[model samples]
Target: MPRTALIVIDMLNTYTHEDAEALVPSVHEALPGIAALLKLARASESPVVYVNDNFGEWRSHHGEILRAALQGRHPDLVEPVAPDENALFVVKARHSIFFETPLAYLLGQLGAERLVLCGQVTEQCVLYSALDAHIRHFDVVVAADAVAHIDAQLAEAALRMMSRNMSAAICSADGITFDARRAD
Candidate 1:
């Protein structure tokens, strides 16, 4: 069985952006599911990778970015999903996690043939990242309940596209299994 890695996209957010008001409620609803998946992945020793936006901070690294988020309006949301010391971190400047980022190479090094994507902007980052992952030949799974969004209708459409177009498995977080040794 191929190894599965959890790719958490842009969840380490400050929630101070223009769409923050529209996005916060969804994040609150999705927080528990994201937290659950993080716990499962950690316990099973599956790779936990955090692919976060740089927020135009050219000098900011993972720790700095995380610190800024913790200091943001919604530290509560940021805390539960914060990366542990063993977790891998990749900084991105765009919507897709793979866009001009080292994520593809990093996943290759970790031998992650399947990716479980969880995080914010269901209609944007998560959607774009799913397409990029599909093009890269990685089996994509989107934790439906674990992803937040700015627009509910667009998010629903994005999930449909992911399933019908990209062949991504659109299921709840509880439906995900992290153990590579177990039969699917």
Candidate 2:
């Protein structure tokens, strides 16, 4: 049995950064797909983990981060895909979710073998996370329509890299499936 987990990365953003001008629209576009995937994951009893960037706010926790994002730039965008009570959150200081975070230990405890990744900055955080997951021998799946990037070209290239190098499954949200039997 291969336990699968949904890794929602950096989607709890305020979109107030310098790159937000180029990134916010794509993030907004990806919202529906992300929400759909979340619904499906929950209904199937799959673990939904949110791997968010701490943005150097060392004192802030997950709740604080969410609150700040809701008050920041794009509340409309942040409101739709906000983390629910059931979601597990891990805060990372760097682009990669596994970096300086309890994500690896947490996923191991969850018995996650396959990771379905969705969320913001496809070329940056998502890309790095996929590579790290691959190195750790976890099956990687990138929800294509569920991820947003600052630049389309770079994102496409990153996806190609993930597919060719990490052998990640690149597909739309509809292609994902959550099975309760997959985990212990």
Model 2 agreement with the true structure over 99-151: per-residue lDDT tens digits: 88899999999988999999988999999999999999999999999999999
In candidate 1, what are the lDDT values of residues 121-142, reduced to their tens digit? 9999999999999999999999
Each prediction's whole-model lDDT (CA): 0.94, 0.91
After superposing all C-alphas onto the true structure, candidate 1 shows an RMSD in angstroms of: 2.2
Per-residue error for 76 in candidate 2, Å, reads 1.2
Stretches of candidate 2 off by over 4 Å are 181-183
Best-fitting candidate, measured by lDDT? 1
Q: Could you tell me which residue pairs clash in candidate 2?
A: none
lDDT of 1: 0.94
Query: Clashing residue pairs in candidate 1, if any?
Result: none
* Candidate 1 stretches greater than 4 Å from native: 180-184
Worst 10 residues of 1 by lDDT: 175-184
